[model samples]
Target: MLSLNSSAMYTGASALSALAAALLGTGTFWPIGLLYEAANVLVAIIAAAAIRERGAAGH
Candidate 1:
């Protein structure tokens, strides 16, 4: 049997959750995956903007 470290296990669990979500939701798996990825990117952009704004404010 193979072993998974903590981070790898967490990542594996996340992937399984995404697969289940895609399978049970409406539409195909591909679209759901795309939407999931898009949401991640949107969040990343928002977080980056907030971090930059905070740094500029000097606090």
Candidate 2:
């Protein structure tokens, strides 16, 4: 059975990243990071709005 531990997750991520880098090349990865950051910001904004609404509702 596979454990959902930190080391397992780290190794999995490392492997995926190496695969992506090998397939996509280094220069392409840098520009793609902007899209990743944009996605992160969008999720954070939505989560913050949801939390604020929940707090306003006294939950």
Candidate 3:
């Protein structure tokens, strides 16, 4: 279940990044959104990786 949520978050981050890039290319103020999403994505990935590592270590 946690993994699922992480996956969703990662997906959302990817979408947000894409949208922000598009907006920026169009000469808009999308940096804030892009930074926010990128951070979320990075956090989600790190969390997921940590969870997997712990599970693998039988902790």
Among all candidates shown, the one with the greatest TM-score: 1
- Candidate 2 residue 41 C-alpha distance from true site, Å: 0.4
Q: Per-residue lDDT tens digits of candidate 3, residues 1-59?
A: 99999999899879977877777887767676777777779889999999999999995
Clashing pairs in 2: none
Give me candidate 3's TM-score against the actual structure.
0.50
Q: Taking the tens digit of each residue's C-alpha lDDT, what string does model 2 give over 1-59?
A: 35667777789668756766664766467655765576579879989999999999995
Of 1 and 3, the candidate ahead on lDDT is: 3
Task: Kindly report which residue pairs in candidate 3 clash with one another.
Answer: none
Give the poorly placed runs of model 3, Cα more than 4 Å off: 1-29
Error of 3 at 57 (Å): 0.5
List where candidate 2 sits over 4 angstroms from the true fold.
1-27
For model 1, where is the 10-residue window of minimal lDDT?
Answer: 1-10
Better of 2 and 3 by lDDT: 3
Candidate 1 residue spans exceeding 4 A from truth? 1-27
> Mind giving the per-residue lDDT tens digits that candidate 1 earns over 1-59?
24557777689669868776867676566766776787689879989999999999996
Candidates 1 and 2: which is better by lDDT? 1
Model 2: lDDT to the true structure: 0.73
Q: What local lDDT score does residue 20 receive in model 2, on the 0 to 100 scale? A: 60
Question: What C-alpha lDDT do the candidate models reach, one value each?
Answer: 0.77, 0.73, 0.84
